[model samples]
Target: MTRSAASVPTFPGSTILGQFARSLISLAKAFKDRREVRNLAEFDERMLKDIGLTRSDVTSALAEPIHHHPSWVLVRCVGRPAEAHKMTAAHKPRPVVPLASRV
Candidate 1:
């Protein structure tokens, strides 16, 4: 007895339902991140600054499109200073120790 193609079982992981579920999960994550970013706005400037962010950074991040992750903007804003510091530190010359001093 041969089974018809329509009678075959399809794995849920490889079906449209799986893709739709994954998309829904991603959307939920984005919404959660957005809410967290919004909460950051309530923090004082000093608190924000302690985390390497500013009021303007929070405002700019919040201004991004709803679908986009606002936390990424904040990450970029916070990273800029650290990256700049790294670049500047890289350019500084290190002092050389005299080989003859090691007796």
Candidate 2:
């Protein structure tokens, strides 16, 4: 009796569950980024200039989708490092190999 690759079940955290968790994390990060952008928009002109930005810059960044990430936009404008925000790709699990398919 042999099982094909398609017959193998993906255990939790191997594929489906891992993808779900990554998506949830991404959503949370996006929300946080959006809030940060909104707060930046509230800053005075002097504060904005200190960060190498203007009112228009904040407006332009806030216009983008939350997932697009405004902090990167600010980093480019300032040409200096600030508080780092990490972004990484989701984990992709390898295809399951059934017992019979093993070399």
Candidate 3:
């Protein structure tokens, strides 16, 4: 016997209420991350550079919409250069030493 669509059970997260709750949680997390980003603003340029970030990065992140997570912007900014550097380094040809050269 085939089960009817009406008889099928829906997962909790697939319900409207569940989606609303998830949205609330995500909003809360964004606000929390924004606060942390604000704290990063207090760091001097040198300090910010130490962590692969700059003052402009913090400013741009803070400029993002309230509901959006600002730290995500900072992460993208910081990660891009590193990722590019890794990609370039990975593709570069390395000198191959002959095994016989090592006595």
Candidate 4:
């Protein structure tokens, strides 16, 4: 009786699957090299909007930057509360605009 040889998957001879694997590896490397954000204060409100977060999120983050795993700290930051002057209860007047003639 004759037995057939078994073939193992590998990168060789410009195969379609090999190309796809290479593409995936390249994408992974690119993502791994991406910049990391370690703090919320560095980002402005507009930048936060791009990533779907608000000001309150930043405030909370600064308050307590702790996380379950130490690795998580590489990209997260807990911001501290604003100074007393900023959070104090004070009223400011808004400018009134005159309406144009609409008779």
Top-TM-score structure, candidate number: 3
Show where candidate 4 strays beyond 4 Å.
1-38, 65-103
Best by lDDT: 3
Q: Which of 3 and 4 is the better model by lDDT?
A: 3
TM-score against native, each model: 0.66, 0.59, 0.67, 0.27
Where does candidate 1 have its weakest 10-residue lDDT segment? 8-17
Task: Report model 3's TM-score to 2 decimal places.
Answer: 0.67
Each model's total of backbone clashes: 0, 0, 0, 6
Model 2, residue 92: distance off in Å is 51
Q: Write the per-residue lDDT of candidate 2 for residues 1-103, one digit (tens) a residue.
A: 9889989787766887889898889878877887998999899999998877888878887787766777777667665323232222234456798777656
> Taking the tens digit of each residue's C-alpha lDDT, what string does model 1 give over 7-96?
988886677888888888887888888999999999999999899999999999989987788999999999898999999999999999
lDDT of 4 by residue, 1-103 (tens): 6655555455466588888898788656444433223354578899876665566665553444332222233234322223333555354456799989988
| C-alpha-based local distance difference test score of model 2 | 0.75
Runs of candidate 1 with Cα error greater than 4 angstroms are 1-8, 11-14, 86-103
Give candidate 2 regions above 4 Å deviation.
1-13, 80-103
